[model samples]
Target chain A: MEKEERKKKVKEEAKEKEGRLTGPRVIGRRDVLKGFATVPFLGAFAGAWARKRHIERELKNNLLEVVHLTAEPADIVPVAINSKPLRLGIIGFGLRGRHLLRATGHAEPQWIDDAKASAASNRLDTSYEDFMNQEDLNVVINGVCDVFNIHAEEAVEAGANIFRQGKGGKMGTVPKRYRTYKELIASPEIDAVIIATPDHWHAPMAIEAARAGKHVYLEKPMTWNVPETYELVKAVKENNIIFQLGHQGRQTESYIKAKEAIQKNILGKITLVEVCTNRNDPNGAWVYPIHPKAGPDNIDWAQFLGQAPFHEFSLERFFRWRCWWDYSTGLNGDLLTHEYDSINQIMSIGIPDSVVASGGIYFFKDGRTVPDVQQVVMEFTKHDLTLLYSASLASDRQRGKVIMGHDAHMEISDRLVINADPQSTAYSEKIKQGVIDPVVPIYSFTPGKKGIDGVASATEQYFASRGLLYTYRKGRRVDTTYLHMREWIHCIRAHIQPSCNIDQGFEEAISAHMATIALREGRRVYWDREKEIII
Target chain B: MTKNHHLREYSTFQALMLVLLRVSIGWHFLYEGLVKVFNPDWSSFGYLMDSKGIFADVFKYMATHKDILQAVDLLNIWGLVLIGAGMILGLFTRLSVSCGILLLSLYYLSHPPLAGLQYIFPQEGSYLIVNKTLIEIIALCLLLAFPNSHIAGIDRFFQKKNK
Candidate 1:
């Protein structure tokens, strides 16, 4: 008891002496107090009245609107093309690339005794924690390629570990590093490729991969430009190979349950849907600090830029490509597409009839071309649905992805909630039978609920639930990337469409491009679905 | 299909605005809670000591009493977080808002608008019969009166599953 008190006193005193125990020493008492004083009740009376009027107007207007939507549970089966022991190669060994490697292994490394001394007495944010926790890869990671020397080395090491495990410690099975993606794609030894490169390289590499007859799992925002969208679509179709776009949210259990609820005609007729991107941290924004080691010497500046207009080498541009218009599709393609694809998966929304995007860089004065705050209204004219997306990099808010039907509204995040509409005629029988209350939430589904009981932080869990980190298979915690990758592998062998496939990828690319054009031009962009082009 | 798309858009915008308001308030609460949660040394001692409201002695007592003070601190930080997350996500919103009302009510009473209540601490902006806490309590009341979740957040998801 005395020891505990002493320890507690020391800790408290240390904290009092230094406002923050770690990170930076910028936060003092005055700063903390200032944080408390900063930005609340901004509208004062006008804001209150504005929201009141808005709610009043909304409730009255929303009553008359209803739409019934269906969620098609894609029965993705194998097409009987190939057998097991499917050969796979990976390109791009950055943050996401490393995460994908974790997916290939089964049992997590139970012990990392060698790195324990650096933990500094239960420090959670140890730099080596991620590097140490490696899973034994089951599949044969045959090849690796990266423009950067460090990335390439990491890939080789990670793949070698995986290979050693899969080959039963035969040793000397280091994956032969390729010079370029084209060389890797052409390699007959590799049957499939997971393209985790930047946005600009997605189409170029994918097009090459398709031509080389390698099944591709390209990342999201599948194309660099409008023309590349059609060209990549053509390549995949002509080659007749299984193509999976990396919108891993397709495998997310929360969204899948949301789909089930929607299929049950919960939200009567879906008229409105709102999705968000609220991440209020420095790392959350694309202002990734330039690694001290990343210079022109080790980095491939020309290859990184690819087909984009050339400029002098800047580490900021190379490291944080997502913040720039030259390489990235900006907020519309990078952020909005996630929300769009999720809703599209649930609602099976094709190309929207029209799109109106508006927002600006209200915060983060880091000279990012894309807006920090983004809002887009996508009108699905035929389905009588309007999809609204709101994103902010300045504030962290736990707003769920919402789809509203006249009868009910389906709120999908980590948990799915359906509240019966008081005026919902479709659900009148259930209400009358006391099966559901008109006001209270009718149904709830929390994916991986039991496993997430003692989570360290809400922020981490938020990312986890989105299938960016982890998920559950039969209540057992599993990396969602594994599931997504498994589906891609299964489809490659089974010869079927993976969750986010060619047509869907094309759709996303086209739609994202449309929104991008609208936002860029500051006008409403129309999609001529028949022509398969943005008008 | 016959409905005016513009009207629907306008109404949806207005409705989303309400959700944003709820989100803004939720962000404020959740942000503060999370900041304190991350900061192990954070305590409500200074705020309690500088209490300028009616219940300064009570607040001061709660701050000074080590055992009771720990509970108060835990409840205050976690309470703000829970209510904020609920309001933001529309998950357990009713309970969170109810808890928020209780929390804000305590805050209001601790620093009530009654006469002869003054302390060394400074107040942010001016408040008469209704200050920030009371105003928030009322705002929460308005939000509770008509939760726009069905129109915006997770409640919409739950609303459909029951049907």
Candidate 2:
């Protein structure tokens, strides 16, 4: 009886010890699950922190004008104009302004449907209504600033404030009214001026407008040279007038999103950026449509050559202004400034340290000053970044903006395409032989144990055909024209700088100007930011 | 071993044929396999089903699940390098050919029908699985028939050299 009792006691002790070690298999499964449950919580916390950091970085980098101007809602005062239904004055009644008016008027709402029709088009319509509802403007002046006179009737009909005069100043006077820029800038009735004039006239008109305390929307290539650029900035600051640079790309929602993605490190550390704008014909060289009747009768010749050496009022020079070095800064300031401004806003990289370029007028020898093919390399010191800009008037191969980073490459176009480098087969072979096959348990898994759920075995067969791991993140497409324009207008109302403000515009202009100088001088030109010149 | 008795010897003729066939098959495998092993830019997983339009969806999914593709790539490289070397040398002749056949068969099955049957030729009327897999399968058959050890091979050399 005692022996039986001892055997029972021994069996019971063993059972208790086993229970203590294994912790009741059924109950332990629950505890294991409980421990696993906290994993998601920790993951969520890390994800949120990462997201917060990205948001903070983006906000800091973005030159948000409204945020800088107003903190309290009550401090914001809506501008009141004399005209009913909110007047919009567009000073530069040129090609850009006409397109702007057409886009803002017809496509503003209808563009939404068109974007939805095409998968590649970005969804820019979501914020379009916000622009119309944001503020009540008194007038948007349509000024005569482009190479050709943009019909002011369109602005007038579109419910905008139009300030325009005939080609020969004050309705066909032999010389042209406003021959001296001071007369054009000092027009009292005009509430504001959009300085979309020639490169030389840009600074003088802008400075005068700022001096007159009138809001100004100055087109790109902010000034003719570095000294004038400084003077323009000083004048704007001193007068405390609402000044916005016409680097309209900053207003693009797609660009803004790309910038946000970069600041978020979605692309990791950006090392190289490539921007290419190419065309197959001479028209792409900015030799715009020349009217059959283009002459001194239709163009203000003196104003067109303002501040620059006076030349004969040739129709070819007036219409194809971009092809000449006398009026336009050729390929650099004419086209490159727009790209440079957009890129600076996107990558948040300041002025480049050095710039080198090589280009020649090889293709279009037809009365053009700029090269048919131009390639510029810019090196930035602040972030160890390199940017290359290639523009051609001959080739049609378009390799648009590309931002290469460690993780992925974010390419901007009508739609954004983020891609990873294709895996090397030789490297993969080595990994399979040297590392993965030996280490990964999943790789070597075999059909051994059967699950309790009564599922069939031979599970290893399923694991044999698996491929490598990679992730792709793509955003919804969105157009930027309306958004960029709206952002500019909003900045004006808030008394803050626009997205592509004067500083960004000047830097881009300098970079573009340097590229031209490099090509012209047959030597590399480095940007000296402190000195503000091409060295 | 007289000259007249040699005329009736089927074994000698068979061995001669086998030797010639095995050497030829081994050489082909070695040549193809070595090139893939040494070439740096070769990638297997990157373009499994890359195409325009809807085909992009297939490639995108394949791109995400790459481990298996990677393993297969490694296997192919080694199977060509080591097995091809072994077969060509006739050191582990039968074993090398078997592995080569196995790898070729797996690749054949991965993308069946192997593009088109039309390859480089004077348009000979062909009706067979004449892909890399088929070549390997034929090589394996030839290897099986070969008296690689007794015939001209390193297996015999090693045995003789050591002796």
Candidate 3:
């Protein structure tokens, strides 16, 4: 073995010496700079190239607007429950919290038959007035909490069905209000808690709720920053409690089908996935109007500041908290998390190896800190996959989410469509047999319709429908948030893991923070697996 | 003209000519890429918007979709730099030239020289379905085809050493 190795080395050295003599021995460095001289040469001539084509600025603009190719909500697994009703305490009865409450049980009194009648009446609806009755869900909104007395009052009032005032069923009673989340979570009457506080308060409140032996149904983003992400997940696990992250899009039907396609390897070595958000409306962009009743009196200014920095009572900051970095996680946590978590749910991608994000506060210059436009690229090196997320607040162009694989690509927007790649090796056999045609898609699924079932603007509802935020059953519509809340309630009683459970929530928190850190610091951020943190 | 004869030796003028072509193309890529890198406002947005000829929708799509548009912007900028640097330095000739071919081809296809499409801007020269992008692609093709051309490059020094 040694003799053979010695012989190989001698032959290699001889080849190297021969190689040196044969090639140019002294190539001038100046000769290389001659290459750079072509810049102006190409640049000058490329003009003719640019000018040769007629400009269609508007056509280009029309093409570039955002798309809404999101999937519809999944049907709740129909199962009989023997356990008694679970008491659900809700903290942060802000806009999203109120909606969650309505979806969970508030719309039980209403039905899909009403939405059809409303749609027939030509009313633009975006309310949770039509979801199927989750009568089997063991949940009662017993405790309501918010720093703002008005929000708390509205949350409690939201439970009032005085129309059925004399009836002795679920609609008869209303939840008691609390000023602080601590007071609400500590209550012995509450069996589980739904937290929809500001981004900063999520982890602190979730950790406290877990310690108090309450199951958690936290809203999107899951946590504010990196340490909070770890601590919250730890608390949930250590307490052995069921924790559901509010990426209600997990119930999206196209997402479920897409996940099935991925598990089947129908796309074959999936590589790149792109998800986007585009909204032209003011409310959609996070400049939510400051309420007329908002003030330091009705709102507890100090307590609302919870884990965030203290600021003098500013209604704009309180109502439009999503516009600031101190109280929010910007686009990554606010909007991109939806796409990220949805894609994560389908692909089962835990954490990306690295995240590189870029954006600016383009268009909406309304004293807001978070960028109205943002883009994030996440690389899962182990899976050889890349997740791309782009959000634009100024534009209404709907660039839907698309996942590209070697054999095919799955697009989740108006429908779930899978197209065979013409050059795919995996599909070559089927292609040769004329079984797989590139001209036609291999699979297509349209789960829900573009419905204005609830009392939101057509634009806002378009952005919110399970199809984008509102979901549909047989000829009737349901809310994705309701379906999500239903699954959590069922899982809580059955002692089974919910769809967007604690571990998935942890991965999502880490992923969103990775994007946040990357965008904020203007650098490439990597997940240190051993250390369980982004660096 | 025999393949075996050029393997041992080549004329000095021939080596200079080969190096010249390599350096010029390298410079073109590097300079174009670097200019865009330094200039934040620089984008292919105009080019994509004004795209005509075959694959007009492809060009328009690239211009319209933010994700693809952003990617095209970054890839076009960085890809030019890396491939141009490789060509000039005579490192990874095959890999660099291959990438250059693909990039130039995309550019060529984006707006072909097909007749009947006219615009208001000043055009340098007129040719039927052929232009500078195509010419550069041919130049890159020549660089890739010739193994001995790399003798004028640093790749010669580390040619056998690189794994």
Maximum-lDDT candidate: 3
Looking at model 3 chain A, which ten-residue stretch has the lowest summed lDDT? Answer: A59-68
Instruction: Give the C-alpha miss distance for residue B24 in model 3, angstroms.
Output: 69
Better of 2 and 3 by TM-score: 3
Predicted candidate 1 versus true structure: per-residue lDDT over A409-527, tens digit per residue: 87887566567887889878766765555665555445543322111233433343444222211223444576687688777766888889888887788888888888889999998
| Interface RMSD for candidate 3 relative to the native interface | 13.9
Model 2, position A153, has a per-residue lDDT of: 36
Ten-residue region with minimum lDDT total, candidate 3 chain B: B154-163
TM-score of 2: 0.51
Give TM-score values for chain A, per-prediction. Answer: 0.75, 0.63, 0.77
Off by over 4 Å in 2: A1-91, A101-181, A422-479, A529-533, B1-163
- Model 1: how far is A277 from its true place, Å? 0.9
B28 Cα displacement, candidate 2 (Å): 43
Tens-place lDDT per residue, model 2, A52-85, is 5575445333312101211111122344444342
**Per-candidate DockQ vs. reference:** 0.02, 0.02, 0.03
